[model samples]
Target: MGDTFEAVKEVIVEVMKIDGKDLSMETRFIEDLQADSMDQFFLIDGFCEKFDINISDEDARKIKNVKDAVEFIDKAKA
Candidate 1:
């Protein structure tokens, strides 16, 4: 989970162009990071490219926070 969190944090930092020092499992994409719809799209895309996993639209919609993204990626990669 630590590796997954770090990986997800890296993706978020790259895609969002924000500092990752404050990132955490409870951080919210829209609420905390102020990620718009396009940001979310790129985030999902980035995650797919980074983890080599396909995230369906339905599944993508379910990822709202850092924990959600990390957990989803961990599950997909598992």
Candidate 2:
């Protein structure tokens, strides 16, 4: 999960253009990071590219926080 978290953090920091130091498992994309709908799409795309996994819109909607992203990727890889 640590590695997945780091990878997810990298994508969020890049897409959201924010400091990685402030990110955590509980960080919310919309509320905490101030990400808009487009930002959320790009974030999901970035994650797909980074992890080489296909995330459907249905699944993407369920990932509301850093922990969710990390856990999703970990499970997808498994």
Candidate 3:
């Protein structure tokens, strides 16, 4: 889960065009990171590519922050 969190963090940083130093588990994609809809889309795409899992739109909506994403991915992988 730690590795997955780091990987997700990397993907988020890449997609959001933000510095890795600015990231944290509680960082909200929209509120903290200033991510728009397209940024969200790309972030999901990055996650899917990295984890080899498909994230549904409904499921994606529940993932509002880095912690949410890592937890969701951990469950999916399990």
Candidate 4:
């Protein structure tokens, strides 16, 4: 995996208060992480703050898993 992915994982783990060992690209934020809409908003906000990139509401809604967030940040960073 990429450093971007690791960073994204860190953000998710910190925000969701979950074990890092249990996280993966395929892990769904709502289904697996039990995150609600507010949690999702916080997650997107955290990502933007950490990466210095803004994510639109529509775009944020499309991000469903760790892989999506990592890819989004990677592209935004690029």
Best by lDDT: 1
Assess candidate 4 and give its lDDT: 0.90
lDDT tens string, model 4, 15-39? 9888889888899999999999989
When summed lDDT is taken over every stretch of 10 residues in candidate 2, the lowest stretch is: 13-22
Task: Residues 1-78, candidate 3: write the lDDT tens digits.
Answer: 889989998898788777888788899999998899999999999999999999999999999999999999999999
Assess candidate 4 and give its TM-score to the true structure.
Answer: 0.94
As a whole number from 0 to 100, the lDDT of residue 48 in candidate 2 is 99
Model 3's lDDT to the true fold?
A: 0.92
Candidate 1 to native Cα RMSD, angstroms: 0.5
RMSD of each: 0.5, 0.5, 0.7, 1.0
Clashes of each: 0, 0, 0, 0
What residue pairs are clashing in model 1? none
**Model 1 score (lDDT):** 0.96
Query: Which of the predicted structures, 1 or 4, would earn the higher TM-score when compared with the native?
Result: 1
Q: Candidate 1 on 7-53: residue-level lDDT in tens?
A: 99999999999999999999999999999999999999999999999
Residue lDDT tens for model 2, 1-78: 899999999999999988899899999999999899999999999999999999999999999999999999999999
TM-score of each: 0.98, 0.98, 0.96, 0.94
lDDT: worst 10-residue window of model 3: 13-22
Model 1 CA lDDT for position 49: 98
The alpha-carbon deviation from the true structure for residue 33 of candidate 2, after best TM-score superposition, in angstroms, is 0.4
